[model samples]
Target: MGTDDGMQLAYYIVLLVVIGGAMLFELSGRGGQAIRQMMLWVVIFAGATLAATWWTDSGARQQVLEGGRIEIPVGRDGHFHLEAELNGVPIRFMVDTGASSIALGRDDARAIGIDLADLAYVGTAMTANGEVKTAPVTIDEIAIGDIVDRNVRAWVIGGEMDGSLLGMSYLRTFARVSFEGDLLVLER
Candidate 1:
């Protein structure tokens, strides 16, 4: 078989294995001895598969290399110390350039004591679930990763977002950005 054919066959095998495992687990809900043995076999197979993949493949290494922006070693604190906030509400943001403007969660806005009534309803925002109404507000300050900006423009969504997302509205102002593993490096 050709390389493409081999790849397709491998994909199908993987899919079949996944579906079979799910079906087996569902059928094993009766708590029989045979079902318990089957589950043990499945666990062994999963571990063996993971070990084989790690031993035979460099895809994970290649992906890590390609996706690197900056590499920061783990600090003593065991967590990254990044400065970030919008309108006095602390925001846990991942640097996503795909977003057009600064996005804030409704609850987060309220937490920071943002008066939603003062914001202007500009338009609708297209999200993963559906469209949501948005209001524009000028923030007094937004600090991130040790950097702080004043009078930032951000949009408040009608519903709850996963968290406040700091996107292009903030990232665009940076001169350069890089990540060293878990550390984010930003230069303005």
Candidate 2:
């Protein structure tokens, strides 16, 4: 199971333990009024726990502010994926520290208003699949969370890619990029 599923399972287990303990206490001569009050509090606590879990799992918790730094949670796929605005258009990027430069998928480039017809596929990059031709481009702006960079160097891969890559070219701009537990922190 994924982290989300594991977390949910843990939550349920804790809830059951709490309820079972409450029942045992009630059976052990705890007053009916006290038991009822405890059950009410337990219900309230469970509701709050569920709400918090939902909110955290909803993606809002992925963007965390730590002073001037931003932390992105590692996704279920074990990758740090983030939503960024590229040239005024929103795009999703998978963090690839091994990549020398930012690499945009053809479809992502098109979505960001890049004209494929105008691009010259003169550059080539070696990948696990094979060497793929690419077209160099300079993004006008790329923003993630509150961090923004201008005139960022990137490329449009000539072949198909699952998603745009936020490579070292972009990550190196950060003052520090480190992984702490499951979070990737970008400091500027």
Candidate 3:
């Protein structure tokens, strides 16, 4: 079931349990006071559940750029993932501060009209898996929200990658890059 469906089911189940307990108390001669107390508890539970759901579903944790700054929430994997337009094509990149340059996946490079076959794999990078060959390329423009950079240096990895890496090459251009709690903030 979807998240919303599961949340709704949980709400109904909690409500039923509260009503059942309240009815039992009334039947045992506890009277209206017991029912009222149980109802109050039920309302509190529902409100808490709704708040939790809203926090997760509201996109409040997603990337947002305002003025000359960009704020991105840490993903479930503990990395900041942001979407940008690479040479006018949409691409998702994982923010990697450890990387010296932007590393683009083969598929992402191809999607941006890069001639993969013509690329020279002379550069090599050491990844968690192993050392992989890379081809140097320059993107005309890379835009995230309203922030845009032109002629950004990047490399296309010879091996397959889950997603492109937005490394220090692009990030260092910003005036400031820091993490605040679970958010990564960039200022230019």
Candidate 4:
């Protein structure tokens, strides 16, 4: 399972432990009030975590702050995601600092108006999912709200890709890339 899955399991374990403790307390002449309070705390903690996780990926949307800054709240899977204009078409990309360059999947490349059939998949890249063939391409324009770049070099994955990766090549254009709490901030 993924990190999120592990975390969710841990959360359930904690909840069960708390409930058990509360049951013991009630049996030891405490009362239903104590059990209720304990359950309330568990509910509150879970709600907060769920609410934070639900932000953005569930439609909170990226915030284009003033002064060329963009903030993307972390997704439920604990990764940064941004919806950017790739060749003027909106495409969601997962921020991956480990990636050397922006990597696009077949469908995303196609949506960006790339003619995949003509692409030469002579290049290769080693990813977490092993090696995959790539086709070199230069995007005419990519925009994140008001921030825009032209002639950006990216790779079109000729093999299976989990999704498009917003990698370091594009992130390097930002004057600052930092994380504030659960939000990933990119400032120009």
State which candidate has the highest lDDT. 4
Cα distance off (Å), candidate 2, residue 179: 1.0
lDDT of 1 by residue, 1-188 (tens): 64545985698578658866776777675668657766676777668767865764422211112222222233333432233656666655444566788887776677777887777777788887789889987778875534567888888988667667667767778677666665555556
Error of 1 at 74 (Å): 11
Residue 43 C-alpha lDDT in model 4: 83
Worst 10 residues of 3 by lDDT: 56-65
Q: Residue 169 of model 3: what lDDT?
A: 83
User: In what order do the candidates fall by lDDT, top score first?
Assistant: 4, 3, 2, 1
lDDT of 3 at 9: 85
In model 3, the number of clashes is 0
Count the clashes in each prediction.
9, 0, 0, 0
Between candidates 3 and 4, name the one with more favorable lDDT: 4
Candidate 4 stretches with Cα past 4 Å from truth are 1-59
Superposing all C-alpha atoms, what RMSD in Å does each candidate have to the true structure?
A: 11.5, 8.0, 7.0, 6.5
Give the per-residue lDDT digits (tens) of candidate 3, residues 112-179: 99999999999999999899999999999988778888998899999978779999988899899999
Clashing residue pairs, backbone N/CA/C < 3 A, model 2: none
Please state the error at residue 173 of candidate 4 in Å. Answer: 0.4
Candidate 3: list runs displaced more than 4 Å.
1-57
Q: Quote the positional error of residue 51 for candidate 1 in Å.
A: 23
Ranking by TM-score: 4, 3, 2, 1
Q: For residue 135, give model 4's deviation from the true position in Å.
A: 0.6
| Winner by TM-score between candidate 3 and candidate 1 | 3
